[model samples]
Target: MDLLRDVLKGQSAKVFFSVFMALIFANPALASGLASGTSELTAFKDWVWTLTGIFVFLFIIVQAVRAMMDQITWLEFALSIVKVVVVGGCITVVTWAMGVFGVAP
Candidate 1:
């Protein structure tokens, strides 16, 4: 907690980022621990897919409400649609690639 407080209240952002970068780059034990947890990580990947679907559903609902309330411009709505489509397409590609790689989803 003290370390976090010191980092947050530090005079320079550079100091904080440097410390963060150092920890991530210099941490071999952390990487090894994660590597050993690959089987457990598969469970979290399933949760990630569920959360992604929920996020897309919620985003569409919010956009629909905002549109009905006349809160968003047509251009913004169009852009939002494009962004959602792109994300969906990416997910589809990843799913396809996983199938091709014979990864059990």
Candidate 2:
């Protein structure tokens, strides 16, 4: 499970873990009645993304602080921001693909 561990250690892992934990602990009844009880899924998705957004905000703040402190170069700070944006875009694309395939919640 080293691969999984590595994945979970990345910057976007906060988002991934929030989504993962929500799904893992999802209400069985709500999850089972997908057609009639979509509220649960929608709320869970929102919650996960909300948490992810908060974590992303925190990451940017930390990066900004580090840059201000000269711990990392300005170029490195810009690249980190780009990396975060790229990762977020990738997630958006993946979710879009899942929806297109009628596999998303």
lDDT of each: 0.79, 0.83
Best by lDDT: 2
Total backbone clashes of candidate 2, pairs 3 or more residues apart or in separate chains: 0
Instruction: Write model 1 residue lDDT over 18-100, tens digit each, in one string.
Output: 88789867866445676655755777888988998899889878887888889997678778879999988998899899999
Residue 9 lDDT, candidate 1, scale 0-100: 83
- Candidate 1 stretches with Cα past 4 Å from truth are 1-39, 94-105
| TM-scores of the candidates in the order shown | 0.49, 0.62
What would the TM-score be for candidate 1 when compared with the true structure?
A: 0.49
After superposition on all CA atoms, how large is the RMSD of candidate 1? 7.4
